[model samples]
Each structure stands twice: as C-alpha cells, then as structure tokens.
Target: METLSLLADGFSVALTPSNLFLAVVGCILGTVIGALPGLGPSNGVAILIPLAFSLGLDATAALVLMTAVYYGAMYGGRISSILLNIPGDEPALMTTLDGYPMAKAGRASDALVLSGVASFVGAFLATIGLILLAPMLARIAFLFGPAEYFALYLLAFSTLGGIASNNQAKAAIAACIGLGISMIGLDNNTGIARLTMGELHLMDGVDFLVAIVGLFAVTEVFVFIESHGKNSALGVKLGKITIPVKDILRCKWTMLRSTFIGFIAGVLPGAGASLGSFMAYSAEKSLVRDNSQFGKGDVRGVAAPEAGNNAAAGGALVPMLTLGVPGSGTTAVLLALLMTLNITPGPTLFTDRPDVVWGLIASLLIANVVLLLLNVPMVRLFVHILSVPPWVLLPGVTMISFVGIFSLSGSTFDLLLMIGFGAMGFFLRKLDVPTVPIILGILLGNNMEDSLRRAMVISGGEWTYLFSSGIAIGLWVAAVLGFVAPMFLRGKIRKPQAITD
Candidate 1:
C-alpha cells in the first residue's frame, strides 16, 4: 500500500504537461537515433546530455527524457538489424542473425511485429521485476560498510574485465587507460594537479560527454567515411503488423524462458543485454531438437534474443537504482547523469527521492506501450531511412556531433580532444579491444579508489580489513573467479587451434 501511494505521487510528477512532452520527444528522437547505423543508446544519450542541460531540465525531467530514449532505442535497434543486417549495438547483434534472414525471406513485416511484441513482453515483465526487487535490494545495501563497498567495486571492475572483451589483456589495458584519463583533472581531496599537462581545459579532466561522443559516435563516422559511397539495397517491404494466434502459442514457452534468462542476466552486475541474448539463444538451441534450423530464419530464434535483450535492459536498472552500481555501458552513462544531478544513488535514494525513482518507473511502463504503438504502422518510415546513402549521411552525422559537442562546452580544445579520442577509438577497434570497459573504468574508477582509501583509513592502514568481514571475503572470492573464468574459457576455445598448428 505504501508502494502504491508512492507510485501515485510519482505519477503526479511524471504526468505534468512539460515532463510528458519531454518523454514523448525523447522517445521519438531516440527511435530515430537507434534506426541510424553506428549509433546506440549510450551514444544517443551522450550526444543529447548537453541539450538536456541547455534546456534547464531538473533531475527528474532529465532522467525521464534519457530513460525514454534508452527504451526507444531498444525498440528502434531492431529495425536496422532486421532490414539492413546491421546491428545498432552489441545486444542487437543476436537479433540480426534471425531477423535479417526473416527479412530476406520476405517476412520483414512479420519479423518486425514479432520482435516488437516480444520486446514489449520482455521489457514489461522486467519492469515488474525492477519495482518488486529494487527496494528490497536497496535494504540489503544499507548494511554495507566501507570494506564491503571496496570489495564490491573490485568485483565490478573485475567482472567488467571478464565480460567486456574476449581478450583479457586488451580489456585490462583499456581499463587502465580509462582510469588514467579520468585522473587527469585536479584532485578533489588534495587539490593537487595530477595530469593536467599544463592545459587549462585538462583542469576539469575529460568531460564524460566528450569521451562518449568521441569514442562511439565520432569514431563511427571515420569508419563510415572509409566506406562512404557504399550502400546496402534492401527490398523488404513492411506490411500489416499482426501475429497469428497459432504462432504465439508455438513460441509461448520460448518467450517465458527467454524473459527469465534476460531478467536474471540483467540483475547480475557487469552482465548486459548481449550476454542475456546469447545465453537465451544457447539455451533455446540446446532445448530444441532440430537445432539445424535454429539460425536460418527461425521465428523462435528471433523471439528468444529480442525478448532476452529487452528484459536484460530492464534488469540492468535493478543494480543501478538499488546498489548505485550500473550493469551495462548505457546504465553507466545514466549513472553519470545522476551524479551530475547531485543525486547520490544508494539505499537512501528510495526514501529521499521516491518521486524521482517511482516516476521514472511509471514512465517506463507508459513508454513501453507508446513504443509498441509507434512501431506498428510507423516501421516503414524507419525502413525508408536505410535508403539514404552513406556518403550523404556520414557528413551530416559528423557535423551534428561536432556542433553538439561545441555547443555543450564551447571549447575549441575539447573539439580537438574529441577528434584525438576518435582516432584512438578507431585504433582500439582495429585491435579488437572493447570500448565499453574503458567507459566503465572511467565511470567507476574514482569511486572505487575512494572506497578503497576510506576502508584503509578506517582500518588504520591494516590490509586485512579488506578481508575481515565475511561479505568482503566472499566478494573478493567472486572477483577472483570473475577474472579467471574468462581466461579458462578462452583457453579451451584456443586449444584446437594450437593442436592443429
């Protein structure tokens, strides 16, 4: 009943004329960004962070806009994946496997409708899980001390290293580089300048907005330019959107299982939607006897990943809101936005900012319905965007990105830094290192350092304090396992190559 009252209060805040308008606008813009190739939810949020600030939106309104965009992008990502065979991000990659094939088989409309419906089911179910689980998890977090926090941060970093990139060494290197970049500004504790390199702009360190745009958006432009004139011709025509009753009945079990898998994966720290989709696909493949038809235009295959990815997106929010820890790249961006708003996320957040928390949740429920309706008849409009030639589109995207960044800070030096980071990102992609961990490292690096230092201080320089508590020790063990498990899996995969060579 208390939760219900709080939700009512949240609705009061979320349903205001201005907030509602922002939510709708954000959903539309996010869908457009998601339909474009080489842009994902994180980049979309990053590019628009400045706009949110410029508009003078309060924390609640800003969050509403960003989260709306996040969900909208999830919906829009399927469009490109199905029609163009190009995934908008890692999570959408699984959708392309079956979705594109379905489009090729002239079932483009069917694929779009099924994926949209599955996404809605997954997302809505996960939202219920988030509402039920977040407060309980936050209560558990209330018992944590400095030692526990330190250990938890270590576990987050280690698991990020494990799950982010296939190559552990490259992942570690990316993390270290991000930490170094984050440390460039003035030290808050000691007021000592560290890595400013004598530049006035470096005094503020690198802006999160600048880093995200450079790494994801600007870097993508350079790649797009290399293949500038090339275009993929798509003949798939979108028709009426509807599911046969029989088809839904056939895939009911798959939907239920995938939803469970996605929600569970999303709740685990460091595991994102991609992992959920992959796990669901694997689970479904193993459960089905005729796995040979799994990837070749199977509707079940399309349903599993779409459902899993959307569920995972909802799941990722669980830790972010409850524990002040984000489970994915985009959530990490959300975390940054929260910090900028001066709203510290943790146990007290639910009590102190119930309006912000519940309003966002309620809005998500509304947005899910809105996205489904928007996708049904309007999907053909998104497909038309795919027809725009890369040569024309690349320059426009680049110009928009540059203008957005400059408008945000009005710093010429930051623009130069943006280009430099863009070059660095391109090189990192060529080396097969994941960029997500780098962002994670930058986002979490300072907090982890502060927790560790505080724990050490509280223990009077005793190293054993880190392992003194049962919770701390268990977390340390989990961190060790997270770091090692990936290496073991990689080794197993490489053994055959070594033997053959």
Candidate 2:
C-alpha cells in the first residue's frame, strides 16, 4: 500500500505531457535500433545520452527517456531474432534458438506476438520487484563504510570478470586496462599526474561517453563492415498478430517462472540479461511438455527467453539506482549519465530526490506499455529494418557517435581518442573478452581507489584497516568467492545461443 501511494505520486510526474512524449519517442527510436543488427540497448542508450543532455530537460526527464529506450530495445530485440535468425544483441541470442524456427514454420506472427507479450509480462513484474526491493536494498547499503564499500566494489569487479566472460584471465586483463586508464589523470591525493604523459587532454582522464561510443558504437560499425555488410533476412508471412487465448493460458506458468528466475539473475552483482534469458530458456526446455521441440519452433523457447531478458533488464536497474552498482553494460552507461548530471545514485538518491527515483520507475512502466503497443501491430514494419543496407546504417551510426563525442568535449583530440579506443575495442572484441567489465572497472575505479585511501587514512596507513569490520571482511570473502566459484560453474550451466547473423 505504501508502494502504491508512492507510485501514484510518481505517475503524477511521469504523466506530464512532456515526459509522456519523451517516453514515446524513446520507444520508437529504441525499436528502430533494436531491429537493426549490431546496435543493442547499450549502444542505443550510450549514444543517446549526449543528445538527451542537449534537449535541456531536467535530469529526471532525461533519465526517464533513456531508461525507456533501454526497455524498448529489450522489447524490440525479438523482432530480428524471430524474423531474421539474428539476435539484435547478446541478450536476444537465446530467442533465436526457437524464434527463427517458429518463423520458418510460418509462425512468424505467433513468434513475434508471443515474445512481445512475454516481454511485457516480464518487464511489468520486474518493475514491481524494483518498487518493492530497491528501497530495501538501498537501506541495507546505508550501513556500508569506506572499507566495506571498497570490498563491495572489489566483489563487483571480481564477479564481472569471473562470470561475464568464459576466460577469467582475459576479463581480468580488460578490467586492468580500464583501471589503468582511470589512473591517467592527476592523483587527487598527491596533486600529481600519474599517467597523463604531460598531455593536457589526458589530465581529465577519458570521458565515459567517449569510451562507450568507441567501444560499443564505433566497434560495432567495424564488426558490421567485416561481416560484408547486411544480407537479406528470411521472410515469414505475417498472420494475425493475436495469440489464441488457449496459448496464452498455456504460457502462464512459463511467464511466471521465467520472471522470477530472470529477476533473481538481474539482481545479482554481475549476472545480466543475457545470462538470465539463457537460464530461463534452459529451465523452460527442461520443464516444458514438449521437450522434444525445445529448439524446433517451440513457443515456450521464445516466450521464456524474451520474458526473462526483459525482466532482467528492469532488475538490473535496481543496483544501478539504489546501490550505485550497475549489473550490466547498459546500466553502466546509465550510471555514467547520472554521474555526468551530478546526480549521485545511492541510498540517499531515493530520500534526497524522490521525484527522480519514483518518476523513473513510473516512466519505465509506461515505456513497457508503449513498447508492447508498438511491437504487436507494427512488427512487420520493424522487420523491414533488416532490409536497410549496411552502408547507409553504419555511416549514420558512425556519424552520430563522432558528432556526439565531439559535442561533449568540443575537441578533435577526443575524436582521435575515440578512434583509438574503437580500434582497441575492435581487436579486443575479436578475442571475445567482453568489454563490459572494462567499463565497469573504469566507472568504479576512482571510487574504489578513493575508498581505499579513506580507509587507510582513518587507520593511519595500517593495512589491517582493509579488514576492520565484519561487513568489510564478508565483502572480501565474497570477492574471492566471486572469482573462485565461476571456475566450478563454468561448464555446468547450459550454453546460450551465440547466433549473431
């Protein structure tokens, strides 16, 4: 009841004409990008942040718009997965295991509608989870001190590198690179440049937008070009978009189970949409009546993965908003936007700025509705995005990144730096090292360092300060377990669909 009252208050702000309009626009744009190969939610959200700032809207409005885009992209990713056998992003990969087969069997409309409805159900439930759980989580975080916070951040870094990638060594290296990059600017403790190399531009450290633009948007362009541009997607004739009432009834349990599974995965420190969706698909495959049809046009396959991934997307926001720890790459970008806007997200965020927190929650619900409406009836139009030639799409994306990054700093040097990171990103992506943990490293690196310094100062440089408190010791144990447990879980989990094209 208390949550309901607060949510009603949130609706008052979210329903303002301007805010509603932004939500609609974000959904449309997100769908367009999600339909396109190589442009996932993270890329879509990252590139749009700079433009969102230029819109002159207040921070709440901008966050609402960006988060709406995130949800829309999750909803839209299924379009290409079902129609073209191409996942729009990594999280959508599991959809293709059965979605494309359903399309091939002349059930394209069914596949799209089922996935669309599942996405809605998942996001709706996850938002409720967010409403109930975020405050509790934030309250718990209030007890953390500098030492506890450092250990917590270390746990985040460890889990990200340990689990998000197949090879922990590569993930660690990527994180180290990002941490090293974060140290390029002057050391606040000593008032001396550490790795600036005397370049004035390096004194400020790399802008998060520049890194995100280069790593996701620019690297994606290069990857698309390497694949010899876009090819034609398989066409499946559309029937009525509506699912039969019988089918909906049958899927009730699948949707509910996947929602819970996905939400739990999303709330974990490093598990994200991709993992959630994959786990849900695996569970559905095991429990469904027709296990024989698990990957061969199984509607449950489409329904479960779509629901789980969308739910996970919402769940991921819990840590980002309440604890200032992003569980995935997309949320990492959102965190960067908050920092850029001088909005520090933590326990105090909800208490200090209830409007932003509640308003965002309300807007996310509205965006889910918008995405469902857009996807169900107009999916045929979205599928047409596959027909767009790569030459046209790639250039537009590249131009957008270049223009946005330059606008942020007004420096050609930043452009060069972006290109440099683009090259590094391209090469690193070739190794499948997972660039997300690197961004996480960069985002949390300074804070982690500051916490360490603060704890040491309080302890008179005694190294024992690192383990001064029970919470701090617990966090250290968790960090070590985060790194060690993955080795045991690696091959035990079902492999996700790795389909790209």
Candidate 3:
C-alpha cells in the first residue's frame, strides 16, 4: 500500500502536460536513433544529455526524458535487425539471427509486430519488478560503511570487466586507463593539483558529460565515418503491417520466461542486455523439444531476444537507482547525469526525493506504452531510416555532439578534450578493446578512493579493517568470482552472429 501510494504520487508527477510531451518526443527521437545502425541506448542517451541541460529541465523531467529514450532505443533496435540484417547495437544482435531470416521469408511484418509485443512484455514486467525490488534493495545501503562501499565498488569494477568484456585483460586495461584519467586535476583530499599538466581547466577535473559524449557519441561518428556507410542499403520489402496475434500467443510463454531471465541478468552488475539476450535465447533453445528452427525464422527466436534485452535494460536500472552502482553501460551514463544534477542516488534517495524516484518509475511505465503505440504505426517511418545516407547522418550526429558539448560547458579546452577522448575511443575500438569499463572506472574511481581513505582514517591505518565485516568479505569474494567466472561462462554461452545480405 505504501508503494502504491508513492507510485500514485509518481503518476501525478509524470502526467503533467510538459512531462508527457517530453516523454512522447523522447520516445520518437530515441526510436529513430535506435533504428539507425550503431547508435544504441548509451550513445542515444549521451547525445541528448546536452539538449536536456540546454533546455534546463529539472531533475525529474530530465530523468524521465532520458529514460524514455533508453526504453525507446531498446524497442527500435529490432527495426534494422529485421529489415537490414544489421543490428543497431550489440543487444539487438540476437534479433538478427531470426529476424533477418523471417524477413527473407517475407514475414517481415509478422516478425516486426511480434518483436514489438515481446519488447513491450519484457520492458513492462521489468519496470514492475523495479518498482517492487528497488526500494527493498535500497535498504541494503544502510548496512554499508566506508569499507563495505569500497568493497562494493571493487566488486563493480571486477564484475564489469568480467561480464561486459570479451577479454578481461583488455577490460582491465581500459579500466586502468579510466582510473588514471579520473586521477587528473586537483586531489580532493589534499587540494593539490596532480595531473593538471599546467592547465587551469584541469583543476575542476574532466567533465563527466564531456567524456561520455566523446567516448560514446563522438566515437560512434568516427567509427561510422571509417566504415563509409557500407551496410546502409535496405533490401527488405515491407507489405502492409499486420498484427500477428497467433504468433504472439504462441510466444507468450517464451516472452514471460525470457523476461524473468533477462531481468535477473540485468540486475547483476555489468551483465546488461547482451547477456540477457544470449541467456534467454540459449535457455529457450535448451528447454524446447526438437529445437531445430532456432536460427531460422522462428518467432520464439525473435520474441526471446527482444523481450530479454528490453527487460534487461529495465533491470539495469535497479542497481543504479537503489545502490548507485550501474548495472549496464547506459545506466552508467544515467548515473553521471544524476550526479551532475546534484542528485545522489541511494537509500536516502527514496525518502528524500520520492518525487524523482517514483516519478521516473511512473514515467517508464508511460514510456513503455507510448513506445508500443508509437512503434506500430510508425514502422514505415523507422524503416525508412535505413535509407538515410551516411554522408548526411554522420555529420548530423557529429554536429549534435560538438554543439551540445560546447553549449553545455562553453569551454574551448573541453571541446579539445572531447575530441582527444574520441580519438582514444576510436583507437581502442580498432583494437577491439571495450570502452564501457573505462567509463565505469572514471565514474567510480574518485568515490572508491574516498571510501578507502575514510576506511583507513576510521581504522587508524589498520589494513585488516577492510575485511572486518561479513559484507566487506563477501563483496571481495564476489569480486574475485565476477572476474573469473566469465572466463568459464563465455565458452558455454552461444554467441550470436549477424546474417549477411
């Protein structure tokens, strides 16, 4: 009942005329962004952050808009996957395995509608799970001391590399790079300049938003430009859009099962949507009898991944909102946004600012419905995005990143720093190294350093105090397993491959 009352209050906030309009606009824009190849939820949210700031939205409104884009991107990824056999992002990779085959078989409309429904089921249920679980989890913060927090942050870093990266070594290297970057500027404790390199702007430290835009949005532009729009053509022909009720009914069980699997995966630190998609598809394949049609035009294949990834997207929110630990790359971006707004997320967040928590949650529910309605009618429009030339699209995205960053900071140095980060990201990508860990390291490095210092101060320089509590010890154990476990899990998990034209 208490949750219900709070949720009602959240609904009251979300239903305002301006907030509702933002939700709608965000959904439409997010879908378009997702439909374009290569821009996933992380980049989508990051690219729009400056716009949010320039518009001067309050905390709740900005959160609602960005999260709406997050959900919308999850839904829109399937468009390119089904139509062009090109995944808009990594999580949508599985959608291509079956979605492309279905399109090849001339059931493109069926596949699109079914995937949309599956995405809806997964996202809606996951949001409900967030509402029920996040508050309960927030209470766990009360048990955390400086030692425990340090351990927890360590766990995040360890697991993020293990789960999110193809190679733990490379992920660790990226994390080290991020941590090194975070150590720049003046030391918080001593008030002494450290890595400023004689630049005055370095005193305030690197701006989180600038780094995010550079690493995600600007890097995407460089990558796309390098590719020269080789895969921009749309070969699939769409007939009249039709709702495939029977197919949806057949996949209802698949959607529900995948949603549960995905939500759990997403809640785990660093697992994110890619793992959720893989797990759901693999589980369905194992559970079904005579699983011969998985890579073919199987509706269950479309349903499982679309549902799983979207649910995982929602589940990623659980840690970010309740624990201040992001469950996915996109949530990391959202966390930066929150911190920039001076809104600290954790246990007190629920009590001190029920409006932001509940309002964001309620807005997610609204966004899910809006995406469903918007996606169906606008299928033709989103599919047309595939026809957009890279020459036009690439420059537009680049402009947004540059203009938005400049408008936010009004610093020529920040712009130069952003381009530098973009170059770094491009090189890292060329080497197949993951950048998410780098972002995570930068986001958490300072806080982790503070927690360790505080723990040392409290324990009078006693090293053993770090392991004084069960929570701390457990976190350490989890950190080790999170790093090592992925090595074994990677082999067992079936990797998805894109279909060629």
Candidate 4:
C-alpha cells in the first residue's frame, strides 16, 4: 500500500509537463551521445551539469533530465553496437558479439528490435526492483550509527577496487589520493588546513564538479586524442525494425533471467553495467551449453546483454540513492550532482526528499518508454552520430565541460583546477588506476571522517569503539574479506579491465 502510494506521488510529480518535456529531450540527446564512439552516459551527464545549471533548473528538474539521459544511453548503446562493430558504450560491448554478426547476416533489423525490446524489459523490471528494494535498504540504513556507517564505508571502500575493474591496489591508490585531496579544507577541531599547500583557494577543498568533469569528460577527450581516434562505425543496411514472435518467445526466459542477474550485479559494490551485461551474456552462453550461437548471432546473446545492462542501470541507482555509494561511473557522476544540489543521499533521502527519489524512479520508468519509442523510429538518425567528425565533436565537448565548470565557480581558478585534474586523470588512467574510486573517495571521505570522529567522541575517544558493535564487526570482517580475498584469488578472478578500451 505504501509503495503504491509513493508510486502515485512519483507519477504525479514526474508527469508534470515540464518534467515530461525534459525527459524526452534527455532521451534523444542520450541516444545520440551514446551512439558516439567514446561518449557514454557518464560523459553526457557530466558535460550537462553546467548546462543544466546555466539553465538554472531546480535540483529535481536538473537531475531528472540527467537521469533520463542515463537511462536513454543504455538503450542507445545497442544502436551502434548492433549496426557497427563499435560498441556505443561500455555495457554495449557484449552486444557486438552477436549483434554485428546478425547485421552481417541481414538480420540487423531483428537485432536492433530485439535488443531494444530486451533493454526496455530489463530497465522496466529493474525500476520495479528499485521501487521495492531501495525502501528496505534505506530503512535498514536508518538504524546505522556512526560506527556502523564507518564500517559500511570501509566495506564500500574495500570492494570498490573490484568494481568495474579488478585492480584493488590501483583503486586503493586512487582512493587515497581522493582522501588526501578531500582533506584540503579546514579541519573541524582546528581551523588549520590539511593539504591547502598555502593557497587560499585550497581552503575550500577540491570541487566535486571540477573533479568529475576533468576525470570523466576532459580525460576522455585527451585519451581520444592520444589515440588519434577516427570514426570507426561502418554503415549497416536496414529496412524495417521488426522481431519474429518466435524469437521473442525464445528469449522470454533469457530476458527474465538476465534482468535479475543484472539487477543483483548492479546492487553489488563496484560491479556496474559492463560487468552485469558481460556476466549475463556469459551465463546465457554457459547455460545454453553446446548449442549456443553466442559468438555468431545468437538472439539470446543480444537479448541478454541489452536486458542486463539496462537492468543494471536501475540496480546501480540503489546504493547511490540509499547509501551514498555509487556502483558505476554514471552513478558516481549522479552522486556528485546530488551532493552539488546539497542533498545527502543516505536514508534521509527518502523521508527528506521523497520528491527527488520518487520522481527520479518515476522518470526512469518513463525514460525507458521514451527510449523504446525513440530507438526504433530514430535508429537511422542515431547512426549519424557515428559520422560526426572528431574535430567538431571534441571541441564541442570541451566547450561544454569548460562552460559547466566556469558557470559553477564564475572564475578561471576552477577551470585551471579542472585542466590539472584532467591531466592527472589522463596519467592515472594511463597507469591503470581507476579514477572513479578516487571520485568516490573524495565524495565519501568527508562523511567517513566525520562518522569516525563522531564514533570516537561518543566513546570518549576509545579505540575499541569502532569494533564495539556486532554490526560494525560484521562490516569490518566483510571489508577485510573484500580487500583480502582478491589477493588469494588473484589468478582466479579476472584481471582488471575497463568496460571500454
């Protein structure tokens, strides 16, 4: 009854004319951007933060628009991957295994339709999962004390190294850098700074937007340049988008199975759409056993990844909305936007900002529908994104990122900081360090430190206070296992990899 009540309210807010229009625009933009070679939802959202702000929309409106983009990109990714061997985005990588082959075999229309429908199914179900699960998780989080929170944060940190990547050490190093940077501002007990380095501007600490834009947008630009990337999408011929009824029936179970798999993966620490899609594809391949046409145009292959990734997109939102931990880069950027709006994303997010959480959920549901409608009719148009020259595209993106950071601070100082971060991101990524964890570190570091101090102050500075509660101990044990298990299973677990090269 309560869930229904909340859904009713969410629909009321999300159905507003303005919000509906933003959702449509975001879906269109998202699909186009996702069709691009290097840009994904993370880049789209990161680049739009400033544009959204410049337009001066409220937190709810701005976030809903961006969230719509996030969902739309998931659907759009299949367009490029199915037609062109090039994956539109990271999660779409698995789609190419069968998608391109199907296109080559003159079933491109079927591949596109099936993947699109599967994506809708997964996203729709995942949103349902979010509706049901997020509330329970948030309620559980409400019982957490400072110690529990600290241990939880530690667990989150420990698992992050394994997130979209398998390199725990690189993730930890990046996290440490984030923690170190977050300490730049004045301390609570003493006004003295931790890492200001004698600069007056450092007293405010590193801006999250600045860090996000640089690490995600600017860094992507640099990497693209270093590689001298060219448009690689080869055109595919298509007549009408249609799927055979038999194929839909065949993949019915596959879609259902992958939806759950992807949603669960998305809920896990560090695992994101890429992992979700890959794991789902692998599961289908293994389960179908010897008869699978997995690498050679299996309908199940296309269905699994599209559904899994879309579902994972929804699942990824759970931790971010309920626990302030982001499961993927896009969610990390989303988290940054939430904090930028001065909204804390823990349990109180439900009670304190029902409009935001519920509205976003409702919007995602609409985004899926919008994306489906847009995907089939606009498939041909989306392919054009692959043809846009790098020179034209890169400069446009740079201008957007620059304008976003500029609008925020109204100063060149953050711009320089952004470029510096951009360089740092490029080099760190070059060395195989995951930058998302660092962003997570900076985002969570302040809250973590505060929780630690609160626990200490409550215990009169007792060292044992951190380990006093069973919940805290359990969380610590999980953290330990999370960090240590990887070492023992080093050879067993897959090596660290980015979803996109």
The C-alpha TM-scores of every prediction are 0.94, 0.97, 0.98, 0.96
Please write out the lDDT profile of model 4 over residues 1-501, one tens digit for every residue: 998888889989899999999999999998888888778888778888777877988988888899998998888888878787888788888898889899889998888888888999999999999999999999998888999999888887787775445678888898899887888888866677877779888888888888888888888789879877664554546777665678878999999999999999898767788878987887888888564577889999899999999999999999889988888888988888888787889999999999988998998889888998888756767766777766678778988899888988897889999999999999997898888788888888888899999999999999799999888899999888878787777665553243342
Candidate 3 weakest ten by summed lDDT: 492-501
Ranking by lDDT: 3, 2, 4, 1
After superposition, the stretches of candidate 2 with alpha carbons farther than 4 Å from their true spots are 230-236, 494-497
lDDT of each: 0.80, 0.86, 0.89, 0.85
Highest TM-score scorer: 3
Clashing pairs in 2: none
* Residue lDDT tens for model 1, 106-198: 888888888888888888899888988998999989888888988887777677778655777787888788777888888866888888879
Q: Residue 202, candidate 2: how far off, in angstroms?
A: 1.1
Off by over 4 Å in 3: 494-501
Off by over 4 Å in 4: 234-236, 490-492, 495-501
Q: What is residue 402's positional error in candidate 2, in angstroms? A: 0.7
Q: Compose the digit string of candidate 2's lDDT tens values, residues 269-351.
A: 78889988988999888887669988898778888999999889989999988989898888999999999788999999989
TM-score of 2: 0.97
- Who wins the lDDT comparison? 3
For model 3, residues 317-378, the per-residue Cα lDDT tens digits are 99898888898888999998898788998888998999999999999999999999988866
